[model samples]
Target: MSERPGLDIKLPNGRHIQYRGIRYHGSPQHIFWFEFLPTLLDHTIREELKKTAELAKSTSVSVEQSVAEVVALLNNLVQRAYIRAVDVDRSLMGDGFTKGEARDVAHNVEGYNKYIVEQSNVYVLEYSSNEEKVNYAIVQEDVLDIKPNFCGIGININALWRKIKGKFLP
Candidate 1:
């Protein structure tokens, strides 16, 4: 007998089939950039990065490293808050999901992160899913203007905040 654990009745050839296994790849994840937060809301992120850097015990911590850790925390926080605010099952994203069937269940920093929504100020978010622990990201943080051009457009922060709050909360 083979090491496999399922019933091996090979008598039925075509109509019936058996799935040996299903692999959940934690590395080299498929990333999707759904949307981005404009520089308007990035003030808090800058302060957060400084705080992250200050908390590091090692003096050799670089800005890139600090930004990565904080961005991961923000995304995780948003996802969790949303899940708690409304039951994931109630949300239309997925009507319902079983343990293994839920594809977006990821909080491990060591896991490959695919859905990256970075605060434009930090502009650097990195993830290492496997043994290859290397930072190979090139972001254009230093532009000639040193600020994002909103294309001469104006915004009301108060109204924006209300819309954002309503979308995420309730």
Candidate 2:
């Protein structure tokens, strides 16, 4: 058997597709700008960078080294958050989907995303299936409005409490 698990596709719009393996769903830069940046802003990330710069100035550590460290940290955080978003997208779609099935879902999601962005700056709502309209998506400026399915598919929530409750609650 080949080491490759499934097919890889790079779309014209810069989105990537991996059938069974890992594929980043949306634009990571968008997630960084729309989701991560706002949370990181005026937070420990800034304070840590300032502290590192000051420490580099007083000590023998070069400014370049400090900058590189900060960059690496931010990159790690961004990647993890992006992956989490992709997982949520997958869960919303359904379970035990093949590579081809995932590709179809991704393609549909991308189409809706492009269509919505072209029309306006607000969020785009999408149904998972054309027939039943059971599952849906709500995306704005590329950031998905993820929440518990109990809220009804495609509906937006002010806070993703249940969606993210596991991360905080013991």
Candidate 3:
């Protein structure tokens, strides 16, 4: 099959991103939009992993090897996930992060953690479910100021990652 072109758009966090086969039906709020989230989020999250890896490389901070393992595991969730994209006012989104948007996502979305980050706008919202074989995250900016500008309900059909998640949470 021939590859399709993606919609080149700017994320609210000042990052340029692309979405393939993304049809903006009624402002992109259609249920079908959820079908394209893995592509969008997979790119966004890997970019974030690059940033974190770079920070460790450039700065004095040291990232433990176990940390890399956790990242790898989360990356795996990118494929095994089922995402529920949040519906926000289009005007409120675009080119920057806001604390209110972050809070709104945490409070309004079930199971995701509420994060109050003083130094950064980014945080991972891990979803807790009763299912024994799955894990999920509400990824935003994929942690690049991981804005509330875009967040989702991503469910991973895996029994692992539950124990590893505790290693990074503050």
Candidate 4:
């Protein structure tokens, strides 16, 4: 199969991103734009593990042996919206060709790559040599802000860093 060309677009955040296979569709296209998420999650998880391991090393927590458990925790964080995508969809729809040139009713048009972002609670986790604690905070989006909807302290820090790192690993 040939690789589909992606549409380069900017997120609400200042950072720009690309969505593969976003083309004008006469019908509808179901593209999982976030397919690059797993690899992203992997790198993010490893980094978080290293940090936690270092902290544990200082406190005798032995989190180095808890890779599996930490991984599970990370997965849960993602599922719980610690890490999430920002909402944005672009679409242009109309019936193929209207009978009347000047005035005519258009056909129904819907669907594209849908992105769901959790904009509420942002969770934060800190594992210092002294302590490990998870906390959260709520934030409202600024209407005029083009910056992407981001996860907050209420969200997972690892997840937030993944986005900030901005590498889409395939």
Candidate 5:
């Protein structure tokens, strides 16, 4: 017989203990009460679990393990944001400047990739002027500031970094 993904363990006192295939243990009524209820009132935990199991079996990776792998991948991308900023800076530095045409362009260089993954918590900006452009891209790990001539760009970048990191990291 195939082992059930979940199980019920009964105690000597006739109380039923339910398990969710892992360390999750609780009363059967608490775990499966929604299952026994009417269709309109029932929750979809069973259906969701079935879908998860199907995905895991097809991928040959357990759901728990997949979650860990995904988290690690996200962390790696977060670290790569730094390298991406350097590349953006180099590209901007290579381009010569022309006056009177917006004069300022703050394009997202690294975090654009993160947006594809639905994790656009970081942004890089390229500050340029009419005469010369800065090679070092302003990495707004949280916020970005664009002004014609006024300064405080660094302060705005740091503030934005703090805000974004606070929202996504913790």
Candidate 6:
């Protein structure tokens, strides 16, 4: 009689949930955790934008004005990411590029951040699943790294809060 190969599976209870000669519970959830890090960063940016807009509004600023201000703030937040330089078309000229144009470029920051987070979440979910099909250990490690990055983004957002408070208060 031929001997079957041993399987290695991870259970939800922090134990190896094994299946027919393989790990069954080792799904993309492990990988999804790592992918969650960037999504969290994007979420922090969104929260900062919203908070800044709220502060602007409370100070008697119009919604449009607040949006513009938030956009500028967001530009600073992700300066390292070079998001604005990459996505914004500085070459475009005309009414759209005017200083007081209704469609201010800064106002698009929130939308851009939202789109990035949504797309990243979708991709992470799919990628995690694929990783599970291959190897769960890799995905788990990736998620562990993301946790620290997410925390860093949160700290950045906190600093943004302080700046907004200082700017609008008194």
All candidates: CA RMSD (Å):
19.7, 22.0, 17.9, 19.0, 25.3, 24.6
Cα lDDT of model 3 by residue, 83-162, tens digit: 22333333224333641122133322222111112101222211112231132223311322222323674444232344
Candidate 4 residue runs with Cα over 4 Å from true position: 1-21, 24-35, 64-69, 81-170
lDDT of 1: 0.39
TM values, all candidates: 0.28, 0.30, 0.26, 0.30, 0.22, 0.28
Ranking by lDDT: 6, 2, 1, 3, 4, 5
Would you list the C-alpha lDDT of every candidate in the order shown?
Answer: 0.39, 0.44, 0.38, 0.38, 0.37, 0.44
Question: Model 3 lDDT vs. the true structure?
Answer: 0.38
- Clash pairs detected, candidate 1: none
Any runs in candidate 6 off by more than 4 Å, and if so which?
Answer: 1-34, 79-170
Model 6 is weakest, by summed lDDT over 10 consecutive residues, at 85-94
Q: Give the alpha carbon lDDT tens digit for every residue of 2-100 in model 5.
A: 877766655334455556655322343334322322121111222333444346546655444433344355445434543454454444334345212
lDDT of 3 at 94: 36
Predicted candidate 6 versus true structure: per-residue lDDT over 146-165, tens digit per residue: 22246455344544555798
Worst 10 residues of 2 by lDDT: 119-128
Superposition TM-score, candidate 3 onto the true structure: 0.26
Candidate closer to the true structure by lDDT (higher is better), 1 or 2:
2
Task: Name the regions of candidate 3 deviating beyond 4 angstroms.
Answer: 1-31, 65-170
Which 10-residue window of candidate 1 scores lowest in summed lDDT? 28-37
Best by lDDT: 6
- Model 5 clash pairs are 142-160, 142-161, 143-160
* Clashes found in each candidate (C-alpha, N, C closer than 3 A): 0, 0, 2, 13, 3, 7
Model 5, position 88: C-alpha lDDT score:
44
* lDDT (Cα, 0-100) at 160 in candidate 2: 57
